[model samples]
Target chain A: MDLLGINPVLLIASLMVSATPILLAAIGETVVEKSGVLNLGVEGMMIVGAVVGFITAVNTENPAIGFVTAAIAGALLSTIFATLVLYLKSNQVATGLGLTLVGLGISALLGKPYEGIKSPTLQSLDIPILSDIPIFGRMLFSHDAMVYVSILIVGLVWYTLKYTRVGLVLRAVGENHDAAHALGYKVIRIRFLAIMFGGACSGLGGAYISLVRVPQWTEGMTAGAGWIALAIVVFASWKPWRTLIGAYLFGGITVLQLNLQAAGVAIPVEYLSMSPFLITIAVLVIISARGNQGAPASLGRPFHASN
Target chain B: MIHFEKRLNPSRITTVVTPIIAVILTMIAGGIMFAALGKPPLEAIRIIFWDPLFDPNFASYSRPQLLVKAGPLILIAIGLSIGFKAGIWNIGAEGQYILGAVFGAAVALAAYPADSVLLFPAMVVAGAFGGWLWAMIPAILRTKFNTNEILVSLMLVYVAESILASVAQGLLKNPEGYGFPGSRNLQQYPSAFNAEVIANSGMHWGVISAFIAVIFAYVMMTRHIRGFEVRLMGEAPKAARFSGVSTTRLVVFCLGISGALAGLAGMFEVSGPSGQITIDFNSGYGFTAIIVAFLGRLHPIGILLAGLLMALTYIGGELAQLMLGLPGASIQLFQGMLLLFLLATDIFTNYRIRIGGSN
Candidate 1:
């Protein structure tokens, strides 16, 4: 099939659609980590959101509501996590793993009835001038609302963290929890809200997978996107804008390999699929090589009230 | 204002009872999940806990099968327990498992139709090396680059699965088997087969290795200075550092053991019950072993019993599907519920629950 002899452009366009899910999820997780709580159950929550979003989209025939509803479902599920880590002070890592197992199981069970059904499509949007650009028009500018929202989210998050008073308080709480508590701030409440917001963003990301990327329901279809998002958070050094760059970089690698397979490279197709993960690891190593200063000072450390 | 505080000196009785309470709560939550799924809670409960050991029809087949399933699980969990104990998370045992199978099977296939006693040992070594090498990817990154091992290891599983799919379809595809995508049956090859040493009891080399691993783990965790260091690292990283435990060394040790044991589990599985490397060879044994490691309260004896109990669910769940026309996925969900509720109810391990209202 010849589409104006620009196959790579088409491939890049498709990659953007695929990357949207991870982009949204990673951005949210970046904020969550910045706030000093490490939630490993992103994969599980995304799966649950996928099922809920698909069922809602199929039932109502409105993809927008379906996406919002999925985000709500994810936030509600994350409240369970927040209750444990924030209120009960459970280990975030262990609790997050448990959440993933439970979320995967629940989604599998719920997704059973809706198995083999198609989700409502999310069509591309066209702007007045940007969509009409010569070569790089539709590929970059025209996308589903979720993609643009994720971009906007990146900008907004960056701005907030860099300039806002609330960001100052949140970062303060993350960098030094006991001092923040002594300064008359609500550490638990701030974390709860941050976790919930992150959950919502992640939920929307899963909704994008069901409603756009795959456009069908399959168990474990979120694949390892949640884990990728987590790594990308670290890859970005816990910054929202860098998270976008890392996500799209991953997305580009992910898309390029598939294109290689389509182009019938001499290498095996299996290795093509594996390329994204290998590259992600390579990137992680490069970013992490900066050593002790890369990670957040408070990542994975539980804050007891007294401490 | 009323406040809740953990007692500095809790009784040993409370320690014993908390896990027991966790068990009871897990069962109750599990039963509720089964009920919601339109299955009888009693039947589901019976099938999960009791039917595997007592039911006449399934008991005979499942009794021997228990050791078969438990062997790999115990071996993998024993390795994982060490990492967890040392606060080094290696979540990609599934990837390690697949690499092991692929590496081991590559050898057996390379020597196609050649009968020799050394073939099996060579494959075992290759398989263990494969898993250990895969695990080292994360270990090296974590120690050298300060990368998160949890993400690095977990993501590698997908890559391993792709390798499995590609190899099973391409290089290892049986020539005489009419275009099927799987290796030759190693069980038929006497030199490579891991046959049961004790007939009718599923007591193979794998089971023996599992028992040996448990014994060694028990000794290492209790008697050795390394064990003390591991416990210290997990509970108090600063204290562990000050106490002369090298973080890098612990990372290597924890990840290396887990990878080697997981590799052994994979090697045994390929040579024994599985017989060949096929597409989707891993049935989440690596992931399920995580639950086993935790459910056993991270102890050697606890892991042994947890392995048996978890294995019972696999056998009984299969029986339930065969007899009751239920989907196999449901059983996975049910088992997952056990872990979810277990974690949810374990809030009492450190903190005492205080009533919201007081006089």
Candidate 2:
């Protein structure tokens, strides 16, 4: 009972905070995949963002600048992948994997000096009267600006994907590249932009971790959150709002596990530690069992104009 | 404007030549990186690529270690290449490796003080079985539910890591020692040891298995129908299915073989070089083997050479770190750059850039 004595408001609030990174990443990847580009280097891109954001924040003592730089860094890394897969027509899977390797290695090398370094903290924006409300206020109103920014991004992505002509064209390109090309849509250019957007969001996610969540720089600090974000895209069935749901679900599991550990729950610490990964994957398998009809038809295939 | 023209027939010369070109480019890029870090570029490059094999001072020690390090990489890559050729990606060989080591060590530990020679062989089987079982999760899920094997397998690695930490700190803990977090040193146990067969040559069972696997894979790919089926699936899956190749069977076969080989690598490593089942026993050999498989162009002979080259970097990277005061991360960055360069140059194998071409 004591272990179960969790404050629901606090849990929901922290869940939103924890989910922000993956939400940012998954929503961004949703856009990229919607445009028919599959980039598995999200993990790599996020780590680069984490290190770059940490470094920028340390130097400027400004979290916003840190986040912007992280986005730039992430977008920059994505360009390498875009160039390889789109221009050189390299195998998408292999190139994405290579991108991840590059991101991880470069981040580690660059983050060496920043190791054990504390990042400048971002203050949570507490809405004056809204934050004063007993339970809901604390849950909904008290978070760093990035939390709201992630939700806003999600809403914007959803609106863009569902209502906009650009979204239709992106979807058409993903559904059938040749037809889209015949229709005079520039497939490569569109995919490149989408990938860059994905990179930016992933960067924001990484920066959020370094600046707000852990508030510290560590090697491989993003850990497997990038991978989880990838899974979240699939879990969301490529829908932005579902992506939000999936992220919060994952965030809930993560927060709950940590809370359980803190409360000295009787569960084996190892299982608790592994629950996020195991549960996320298990749920993905279950969701996929219903069918992954949401996957872009040309998702993993490289777009060759000639082919 | 220059545009790439698809080759009607991929150049045979380019197939063999691109890896070499990539290596040279890596050296050049790595030298620049060293220069950026204030170290003498040539000296850093030499220490990494040349000194490991030729320098009289370090070659004696590093040369033998090359095979020792390459042993697991080649064995794992050989198995992975087969799966890769079948379009079946098993990215969690690291997990399979850990489970294999755990199962093998558990067998030996349970049979403590026993002198039966069969014990080591039994452990090997148990190790292989453990890996096979671990790999089956993703394989079965993929076949039955159409789940993405890549995500499933990769996530399993984390689960396996948690289990590894738990086992090392709990059941497998060396009780005789003052609360240490590892198993009994299997290297010290006569019956369970994977000792070097040849004196100081690093010719242990794992290295021997790697060579055997290389030969076996080469022969299988060239002469076996199953190998042809595997290649067909990867190159053209629809055609493979039409040719009566059971997709489920191929997936199971490839995943099983890779898992078993990864397990053997872990078992040999734990009992011989690594000396015990520690929480940190895995040294990313399984993941690195993925790079090795690709670098080898998914060919057996190519994988062997790639494995050796990669191992050289590991040894040379450590040496460079010690001698040049370079960050240890520099090697990881260098290797990543090598893979990037390799993939970039691979474009030449299938296409040629032509001047003044329009589609």
Candidate 3:
């Protein structure tokens, strides 16, 4: 009973940690979708990021370096996706699925030797006076660096999409790539960049799992977090702040399930394990029912420049 | 500088040759991967591509296994291709597959130890219906709520996995088998078993169903008005609409047929090779069927050949693991590479690449 006890403050704080990876990935995906590129390979990128980040941190002993390398790895993989979809004009849905297959296979192959290996733990930072603010401090000011970074990224992405020229260009590209091209904006270049950024964020999220959350290497460690991130992007209605809410809500569900399991709740373990996916999808259905009017008009549509 | 010039008519020669070219490229790349892992590239490629068919010692065993492996793949891919050609993506056939197995197995489990000729047939019907019902979740959602079917279907796979695990450990656990988390082996139950039809050839109800599906799909795509409507819808949705094709109905039909086929594959697999409801009965035939569907160029005959080739890889990959100690992940990477190269080279089918030319 004592071991399974759930403290409200601790539960809320842990929710932030659980949410960070999806938050980072969803925020990045929102940017990519805004640019009219729907990269369904977030799972692939995240797993690749997880394995590469784990190996890098294992060799360098620095989680920061691991995260950066993971981002680079994710971006590099996304380039393959970009080339296939953008240049070759392959089906976006099929290409994205292919990318995921490639990522899972390659990551499993790469992480084979690193199985059962452990890396240095990521330490949480404490704010000076804020750390003394009781429940609020522990809940808000006591997370690892990535937690703060994820929230900061949401803010940065929201500001960029809402108040900047580049943001307008991205939104314009997503709304109608042909019209954006007519306006003389480089549609392909903008989309390519956005896809790369999304890949990087997904990588960082994967790295957070391997280097911070579990701090160990395992094949397919990201599980379906990537898929959850995709659902969250839709649940957020393509909005950054809503993405934050969706991620936390999902993260909260995940953490709460584990706590329930520990508390020896009579619910079947399988049902609890499946709740996050079911809940996210249910929300997606409800949100889309109200109408997907916010979807970028050109979402999932390939772009071509006429001569 | 290079430019891709769109062709007014896709090259017939390229359509036939591109898949071959992509396959050769996969071989070369896969050979390099083997060499990197310190195995003889030639021997590895020979074992994967050639030995499965010709090796006297392994041929008899591998030959039957090929049919066993390809049966489900072909069955599922046939269903998937129908929807794919109609532009309705049922990305979660895997979920339908799992539910079908559960539903079919439940029927058999309920009649355990009974010697009735009707048990297996009942299981088959239950399996197909189970799959169709599972598929309806996405279909209804897409038509009614206008939600993205791809994401929804894929998400349901995870949920289905959970249900599979629950059933294996709970409702389906064998009562008389020392508390093991699996049902009574269908193989031991003659009434409920999907027994081999012809002695020692691995021919079963599943393989027969696959052959039927292939022929049905071929005729549907080539000789039916519905097939033309499907192709028109995929190539030009607005045109399809103008031609009086009901988009909603087409979506439902595509999803329903695919789901039923996927379910049939699951039922056959569970009753035949798998023999019981276990925690990990699904070996990802559903996901792998997607690759098979595309590799076949979404053509019925092409899928048949593709299914055999993929089945060969599975057998050969296992052989390589035993003989050369190559990790299993390498084979998965090889499969993914095939799809990547296929997509990359498909460009040549519809466009000519101009070198150093300004369009």
Q: What does the interface RMSD come to for each candidate?
A: 2.4, 1.4, 0.9
Per-residue error at A129 for model 1, in Å?
Answer: 2.5
List residue ranges in candidate 1 displaced over 4 A.
Answer: A1-6, A292-294, B1-3, B7-11, B352-359
Specify the poorest-scoring 10-residue window by lDDT in model 3 chain B: B350-359
Q: Which stretches of candidate 2 lie over 4 Å from their true place?
A: none
Reference interface contacts recovered per candidate: 0.62, 0.72, 0.73
DockQ of each: 0.58, 0.74, 0.81
lDDT tens digits by residue: candidate 2, B37-117: 899999998898889899999998888899999999999999999998887989899999999999999999999978998
lDDT of 3 by residue, B104-196 (tens): 999999988888989999999999998888899999999999888989899999999999999998999888879888888989988988988
Q: Write the per-residue lDDT of candidate 2 for residues A1-307, one digit (tens) a residue.
A: 2665777888999999999999999999899988888888998999999999999999999999999999999999999888888888887777777788888889988898888888888899998999999888889998889999999999999998889998888899999999999999999999999999999999999999988999998888888898899999999999999999999999999999988988888888898999999998789889889999689998888777773
**Candidate 1 falls in which docking quality class?**
medium
DockQ-based ranking = 3, 2, 1
For residues B307-351, write the lDDT of model 1, one tens digit per residue: 987898888788777766556776676666666555665556666
Model 1 agreement with the true structure over A1-307: per-residue lDDT tens digits: 2323437777778888878899888988877887889999898889888989999999999999889998998888888888878766766877888778878888887888888888888888887799899768877888887889889988998999889998888888888888889999998899898888888888889989998988999999998999999888888888888888888888888877776766677888898888888888888888778763545567778777753
Clashing pairs in 3: none
